[model samples]
Target: MQAIIFANRTGNELAPLEQYYCSALLPVGNKAVIEYTLEDIVTSGITKVKIIISSQAQEIEQLLGDGERWGLDIDYFLSKPEEKTAAVLDRLSLSMTDSIIIVRGDIFRSPCIANFIDFSKQFSNEFVQAKMANQNACMLLLPAALSYLDGIDWPLTHDYDSNSVVTLILHGRCHMIDSFQSYMNANLNLARNDIPSLTPMERSFTSANPEQDFYVGAKTHTGDLSLQNAWGIIGENCRIDPNVVMKNAIIIGNDTLIDKGSTLENCLILPHTYVGEGLEVNNSILCKKLLISLNTEGHIEIDDQALIGPSEHQASTSSTDRNLSTRFFILMLLIASLPFCPLLAFYALIRVMFFKLETKPLIQEMINDNLGRSLVTYSFNVPTRLLSLLPQLFLVVTGQLALFGAPAQIRYATGRNKQRLGVFGPVQLLLDEDAPEEERMLLMLEFDNTHTSTKYLSLLWRSLRIPRLLGAERKKQNMTH
Candidate 1:
């Protein structure tokens, strides 16, 4: 028997999800939507199949290459948006004796195809439609009836006429998910074991507690949370805080972090998402870029990444350690600052005498101490700005401030706006003080959250341009005043 899986559904209803992945690739549990259909076909003893895909075809092709993993010979065909479903099938050109099975990609079902085939052989119908609650489940087509569907429009509804249409009522699980609410419902049902198991990819990282209906993927860390009566599913490489309370939730996708003291109930937290601490997320889908509230049937795209941002892996301590590169860069700045250091010291001495210069605890030092205590501080003067920053080079050399890192913050800086101390930073060099406060804060948070070696080099280059930036800032300030 041959099979044709139509994965050509344009996931307009999926909205923000379609922006990232095709609906066929949407995670239903630990697996994609198409995986369940493939498993059904494989178990039915069909070894050859053709997948018709349109959006993100390359990604899907890469994901299920040749289908050897499932012991099946699979071929992929690209379908156009204008092409009818019947036209797509006509291109295959099956023989008159061939019995083919056609499965829709967007739906999730675990039907006994073998039994359907047996029924089809015994029955005299040319087209057999499987129905669940009076809705189309799937269809079986014989070769003799193939010519009648040539050039017909897609989405063969119940109104489609056939010489002999036999309806097979589905007794088991069948769910058609065309919207976000439907998708969420499907996942919740699956988590509650309302339907048959959707076979997950064979990976060593997956673990399932059948008793508690809890499924966890690999490389995931869960803190001390009670899972006695709750059904929870966590994806790979995720971090769950110890104070979290989760009940009947499906947290799929990788590298997600649930902050401390958060309560999640029947929520779908997408991959690469960061849930801030102490927020109650219930009946919602939290993608890295969007927050979908199932309760209100509405969604909002998240522009500020700090609130519900993308997942970021913490840099290893060794990578962020004061290495030779940092030391060399600090040394270069120190040498350059030598010419102005004595002058700045005299200026600072005079300012101290007049009570203009004051000692402030380094922000980095305060963060390290975690005591949240700091001393007095000298304000940056317009004419002596570069000279004043020159003193920080000594701190850079002493391994106190990184040459290129997050901007320095006061001891009272807390919440999302808190930043580490650096001698010079991307924000001070790139953003004018006149920039929107929210934009500046978000930018700094993003910089601190990202882990890249190139940022250090970029900061070094920006340091050279600092005098120009400072001059511009002063000019802007003077103009404003």
Candidate 2:
């Protein structure tokens, strides 16, 4: 008989992290999250397995790929967010068999095969539905009276009280882990040290000697090391920088980096991070959007998803008010006094010797065109112009000024105010000039001070206090532009 493994993972509450790991890398002890469910399906001696994925589709693709790892001939089906339940099942039934085992990916399970086999065999009717005691544990038993479900509409009137026929509710077990905290607790109980010696679920696919393929996926670095589990899949796209040390950690997903001279122990590092050099990290799940530290002695929900920025500006910003305020004040002071610093003196000497600060010849020639017009030059010696840039350079180095932003132009006395001492140069200033007077002043100030750094910091701060500040402002700007 043929069996179809139906896996559905969709979570709205798990917004940021779910966008990456999804159902792919939930590790119980040394077992990958998807591995446990897949193992249950294939080991039940099912010939064909159909694994479906919702969000984190990329992660599902990377880890499972073509499903050659599962030993069974695996097929995949995708569903749109707007697609309804009936549509999902209809697509699956078109080319597949009637006997189907639907598994939820976000749910993890213990090493149990008998329970699932019983559900499939006894309930091998037109439809079978599985339920956990709650939603935090593996699926133990399901109602097998789905044959009667074929003719009935799944959506019924409010007055109809339908009772399920076969209900097996285990007293002590749950069906799913709804949050990251529960997931971490489940991992602590399931991972074992003897895993490398045992065959992993993926290895069950290889036709070669299974004993040779017994391997574990664990995080490794070239530096001094301390690892809890000596085996596990170090995702192919992960960057294990040199001089980094790791112990008892599993990494899932891609576009992640563990920077140099860092130590990680019993943690999950999700994708896209610098991991900051020379840090002591332990017992945490570093999702790009949130950091879940299972090592905490008490139950603390770190639901700060705002740490992960929306779109491409994730890395270049910080929202912590204390940090932002400190950086701004310190950078402002440093820049204001930087022109006279000793570093500028050394560079000024070089500039004078190399003639780099000499006014361009084109500017000298342009003086004729400005005969009647006011020609203003902040006349400074070659050495002085070189030194004049020191303040801005200091601001940039101090993390106040962005690498590239509109340079604050000196207000030229000419009626043509080409040079102004505001953050927004010509482009933004011109836009602001067209706005209503009161609104223009307010917006101009906002636009000027809203440097690349400020733009990111402001959005991050707003994302926490307000719902859609960054996305809304960005959309508005795009529309106007």
Candidate 3:
């Protein structure tokens, strides 16, 4: 028998989620929601299958590329939006084929396809339906039962079944993402392993002290957190602060960051998101700048990424907030700042020669320079940040750095090198050289992710307030010491 997966549903109800990915592409645990369906097909030993796709169809095709990774021969068909399953089968000339196992790949399904197939193979003249404990979301059809296609629906709504239809309420599970609430519940349940044998990927379960049920993916940086009847699943390459408090079932997606002093409970943080410090997030879905709170039934778009935002790569996407106007304005700022180079150079020379300042700062340190800038370090005997930036004005003239681009500190910071180095970024102003590595990283990430022309202009103006921000930081460091 062959398998057919109708994955064309756009999942309009999954609003904010659709902003990033279609519902089928949404990550659950560590895999996309459709991956479970594909795995089930492979488990059933179905070799040839057809996937119907629409609305970001390229991404689905890219993800499921020919199904060779799963050892299945697959064909892709781009169907029109909201096309009925029966109409698609007709278009593909697959209606008269032998018994076909139809799978809806747009939602979460974890049925034992082989078991269902074995149980229903005996009836060649009747429609067979398989159900989880609560709902009938998957079904199969016999060769003789192909005539019943007119009454069935795209999703497995079995309203057309009559007395001849056999319904098996098996142990399989199907979690619907009809709304944001159900989507959150499904993810939380999966994180807790509430659905048996349904989790696609396996993470290392650690029992280090209070972190009893902590399931973490590979190469993730995290520390132990006390849990009370709670579990946490962190995906690959995530940086979770050591002091983070995670309660209840939580799912942090791949390449995510959870900054220090934050509290996460019953939440699903999407991939490439940066959760800032001291954020007490509970029962919410975070996708870049969009925060969907369960209680409010609405989303809040945060303008300041220093609080919460996307990661470096995700930053360059929609949340980057960089456009032609902003770039043009930055160009104007660069042109405007050029005239000051002579005076700034004179001041730097004076400071170096007399004010007990040394200009032998680092000019050769490498921190992920995507710009291919020439090596020029700017270190000083004393920490004269104002003087240090003078030499970098030359870099700005040559486009080595944005007028207000995100920059890495030449001396102490180990912030992610992927962030662009700017002449003035929040990380440079808000953090002292003695601040914790986590704090620096979080600030730089926020700046790199959401830096716009306006933010750049503000930071330029805020140069006057550097004494205050840095003084405050120094005072905090002094108190800590």
Candidate 4:
């Protein structure tokens, strides 16, 4: 039987994580979601397969190329966004006499397809709908005589009524992973040895503790780490710190590092991530720059490179230069502010004399000369706001701040000290100061994560517009009062 697999379905349900890869390419255990479907088809004696794909078609092509690894004759066809599954089949012009099996690329199942084929042949029916629970497992057996029905505008559901009799096959082992929770659960099941063993692929590294149910991929290093009541799967070339502890976790991709004293439980850490020291990551998915919570289905982008960042090998030199340039720009601003020093002093004296304003010394954490340390500074009240800020500009000259970075508050300094504290930044210039704290934090984190030298001109423009923006905001606030 020939197989027709629709691999183009958009993965909108798995947002954030879907931003990086197609749904079919999502890693389950040692293999991608689509690989399981392919293995099932190949095992069931289907040698000729047609894969219909869209979006990340090239990525899928590069992965399954010619299908030689599975000893199948594979052909790929690109499908349009507006086209339905029926239209895709018609466009491919599959032979009328070919006994065809249709499968959805995103579904995972360990089905004995030969049984389904045999069951379908006894009825001489046009279609056989295989139902696992209430959902269509995306598996359909179409008799050769009914190939002309491929153009029918029907959804791939059990609700279809073909000209011939429809046979139903109930298979409970099939799973449809349309969300982050389902995806994580599937992998967790695999790690826990709850599911049947998948076909093992070749590996470079041996399991540190073969006694435990674990799958360690090629070139991975356990480094004296121990698993407890968990089945761990570490991808190729990952470094697990000796002090780290894991229970029922799956780490995919390559070149990841689990830092010292970190504990992970039922978490999925994507490739090239660095889990910082002493972090307790539980029931979450850590993709590049994003942390998705499995329980709440909420996600956050971690812009702090030191906490959970790209691998060291992927760190670009341009990022280093951009940071250095920010420091230089801050130093220039401090020099320009020197003339206003006397005005600041006079204003401070007026505030103290009339407003009874008292300046309090504050010890603030700062990134000085590329090192993290505390700096002694004076706090300013509302009446002396601008005046008190002048003395802090010296921090710019001393390499403690960036002209266009985060606020200098210690609470905002929790992440990696790589980002320079600044007087004004994209978050401060664009977002209302009265906005919810969580919203503001998310925006700032996103800004820090995506900002680069390419955004230098934009940052400069925003800096120039800050005075006008703040003036308008102040006017608006006064009107509200």
Query: What is the C-alpha local distance difference test score of candidate 1?
Result: 0.65
Alpha carbon deviation, residue 340, candidate 3 (Å) = 34
What Cα-based lDDT does every candidate model obtain?
Answer: 0.65, 0.44, 0.69, 0.66
In terms of TM-score, the best-performing candidate is: 3
Per-residue lDDT for 265-313 in model 2, tens only? 6665554444655766677766554555565533223333333311122
Give the range where candidate 3 is weakest over 10 consecutive residues by summed lDDT. Answer: 409-418
lDDT of 2: 0.44
Which candidate would rank higher by lDDT, 1 or 4? 4
lDDT of 1 by residue, 263-349 (tens): 887788877788877888888988776888887768888776556767663334786664656777878977986776556656655
Q: Give the 10-residue window scoring lowest on summed lDDT in candidate 2.
A: 151-160
Say which prediction, candidate 1 or candidate 4, comes out ahead on TM-score.
1
Clashes per candidate (backbone, < 3 Å): 1, 17, 11, 0
Question: Which regions of candidate 1 fall more than 4 Å away from where they truly are?
Answer: 144-156, 159-164, 197-212, 227-229, 313-481
lDDT, model 4, position 391: 61
TM-score, per-candidate, Cα-based? 0.61, 0.43, 0.63, 0.59
For 185-295, candidate 4 gives per-residue lDDT tens digits of: 677666555565453342323344554455677777775443344556677778887787776555556678878898888789887678887888998899867889989
lDDT of 2 at 84: 39
Question: On residues 128-233, what C-alpha lDDT tens digit does candidate 3 reach at each position?
Answer: 7667757656455646557665433554455545466777667745777778887877776676567767653656565333433766788898876343345767
